[model samples]
Target: MSNEAYAQQCNVRELMREDANSEVFFQKYTLSEETAARLESIREMLKDDIAQANPLWKVIAGENEEEVYSESETSNNDDESNHNESQMMHDQLVVPSTQFYFTQTERTFVETSDTSAALPQRCDILESACESLERNNGRLDFVQLENLSNEDLIPVVDEMAGKLSLKGIYNLCASMNNMTIEQKIKYLNVLCTHLLLPKIIELEEPSRLLSSAIVECVKNFPDEIQQFIFVPLLNAELKDTMLITTIINSFDLEKKAILLEEFLAYVKELKSWHISILQNFLSVRLDHNMTDKITKLFSGKALYYSKDKTFGKLILSFLKLNTALSQEQKNLMVEVVAVNETLFKRPMENILKNM
Candidate 1:
């Protein structure tokens, strides 16, 4: 081959090899097209850093090539150096391949009292409440809270619920001892409106105090509590058994029955832990009517809980609670109970004979 033709052939082969390596690098890194574009933009932004680290740039800028050589330079130093420089330049052109996951802002206990000066002037009630509470060592004066109208109290409660730490909530609950039932209900409504249950439940030491205050408030205002509290608590995506039990136990028997019925209607939408709670309630609290309702609800879906003997036992236990079960319900109970007779220990024949 002619010298020039041979050179052209070599150049084409080198280009093909470089393209193949680039494709493999992209596949290995799983770089999407959009991500690759973003990386190109970042590379453009850091062009100065790339140029400084680039050996070709050093040569172009009139730096001595030998000055860039390391002590590890081989006997084939020219070829090795060229290859190493090319690889470094290629790496500089691509984005770092480390998987980037989005992170939430670290939760630090911010001192709202210290930052009170930065609060908006419009939040006067909030500002006053914080200052007054802080001055009294976090004890809220009932008279002071009572004097504020719903309009004023709401903003203050919202500010505290949103910004205060668990310690602050504990302090607030301590002061609530002197609050009237009406005032306590109002304050709790504000907290619930702002969806603060997760934060309240997170308070390991003061959770009982917080839960007690909430339960008391809920008891006083059960008629109006759903919109402000129970609805928010139920929809908070939390699996906190303590919180759920506290709320449920606060309700009267009639309300508790209604709540359980509502929960059963939407059982399929609930998390497993939530369903377990309902099962627990049913095991102990189910009455004749409630048992009948549940029997009808699960009549066709017996197989759903068939694999879980504990659940089957819970269902069968409902039968023991009700002696007036219809023949249909009795039959359904037998089917469910037979699936897990080990839980009952007694023979199925004897249990059926008593029925």
Candidate 2:
């Protein structure tokens, strides 16, 4: 065999022996200089062959081969054709650029619906709500109020008294601007019955939460609506006294007198505290025409039913202090004090002096 072939065979045999006996016992041996040199050359040839087989190794090896070629060409008189061959190898090892293809679909235009326009009108909602309530015998309770929508409850908002939530009442109030006169009348009536009067009578600090909505409604309407809608509601058995202040502060003097008289008409039945508070709020000047109406509040039956005659005296004092009262009305106030003096159990000295 040639010396190179023999060296290759010996290297293969030595490797097999080392792997086979590695765990049992390691054996050391030396090769001749000629065999070692030949074996090292064969190893370099095998390394190049393995590297060229791998794509990544081919790229690294290609760069190294180009550099070696450049140095060899610079040192030696290598032909231009050989340098071209090295560049060709580098190009062959390079990864090719890939082209991507995409297809765009046509854009679709969807028709969006207008939800507000699709909503049922107020009349239709009322009719449906009426049918629902009729099925339950025209009754509404807290649970029913919770389940019903605002649009359904607005028409029958009066029946929602004491059952509706404050948020629901406010939601209804927002819709009041769009309400007809009759609708607003009924709404304010419900508000008085359920929210405003109870709070006023209980002496709760007037809630802007409740009063603001009512004031907004009333202030927006004309005199006829005020008289026909608000005055009667204020005069109704349930009195929201704070709203009286709202009216007196908001309306002209003429309208204030008209509305004040409406409230005075119900004075006999009102709580004494309401009477006292309201008497001081009179913005219009007192005349003899109002005396009969005013003195009637301190009538025999009024004092008889009165738990607090001092309230009656206080009310009388308010009348005496009225700079607007004529001398004749002042005498009538003194006579009311005299008639109630036994029940009042207080000196008439102040009442007499005020007169």
Candidate 3:
């Protein structure tokens, strides 16, 4: 009974946090009419963030281009549309509730009282809301097609990592083994951050469309991601992960520094970590005949590490590995880069020039 009352108070606090005088207050806190009236007196004490989204739906839906749904018209027609979503939609609602997440940008927006809060809100909320809609079999046909073209759908992948039960993500990872790079990216924007690591592990076939997409997407993640997600993933699977072709496919010289930072970080970890990842990275390099790109990308840096016993074979692999994959642009990438310099900017320009 005490737990139940505590839960009720929590709900009331959330509702009151948004706005106090609204009819939605009744929907949130159930009680005898007398108690409800007393609760109503304190409604104005709360802030607007606690307000339920339903009250604001029509206003936001007005932004929908298909037809203008005014606040009054929506309320009047509410009973007519069979698709009126359930009130429990709030439980499934993930975004717009800043209480739930603490992304760097969201933190900045909140602490500064910046109106630019709306900036990150669109990409961030839309992704979670879409997933919630998908799980409920909500009317999301338009969303599916709309997302098909949202190429940089990182939030989707990130949300999927967060929202899906482990069992669901397992199924998705299995099924995604057969998808294209584009499909994976579309699906990626829906994943959550925690799950991104395991999903990266699932991309084992370096040549598969999914693996290529994973490599392409993370190539630009913030520095921390390179340390945690990219480096650790490479460490975990460098030998077993089938990364040869995926890295080869990632031949965009412009992303090399971001790429190199990841590799260098891999080498700088505790000796135990370097021991694990370098073994795998070296094995893949040796087996795959990719000497030229490896040599060029590693340039002068190879000499420093070559003294390590494992280094000899990889260096030899460079001397003997085939150049079948080295086209003109890759050769140019090799020619210009300092042996170990990060290739951050020019890879893009080079890719564009090639195109």
Give each model a TM-score: 0.46, 0.43, 0.27
Task: Tell me the whole-model lDDT of each prediction, alpha carbons only.
Answer: 0.59, 0.53, 0.45
Q: Summarize candidate 3's per-residue lDDT along 278-343 as a digit string, tens digits.
A: 334443433222344344444444445434444433433333333334465345434433232233
Best by TM-score: 1
lDDT of 1 by residue, 286-325 (tens): 6566666666655545556556655555555555566677
In model 3, which range of ten residues has the least summed lDDT?
Answer: 336-345
Candidate 2: regions farther than 4 A off? 1-155, 178-205, 222-225, 228-230, 233-240, 265-270, 300-302, 305-313, 323-332, 339-355
Off by over 4 Å in 1: 1-137, 140-159, 173-188, 195-206, 218-227, 231-236, 251-255, 258-271, 279-289, 296-310, 338-353
Q: Which residue runs of candidate 3 sit more than 4 Å off their true CA positions?
A: 1-192, 202-209, 215-229, 237-239, 243-248, 269-311, 317-355
Q: Which pairs of residues clash in candidate 2, taking residues 3 or more apart in a chain or in different chains?
A: none
Q: Which candidate do you rate higher for TM-score, 2 or 3?
A: 2
Q: After superposition on all CA atoms, what RMSD does each candidate show versus the true structure?
A: 26.5, 19.9, 36.0
Better of 1 and 2 by lDDT: 1
Best by lDDT: 1
| Alpha carbon lDDT at 200, candidate 2 | 41
lDDT of 1 at 219: 59
Quote the lDDT for 20 in model 1: 78
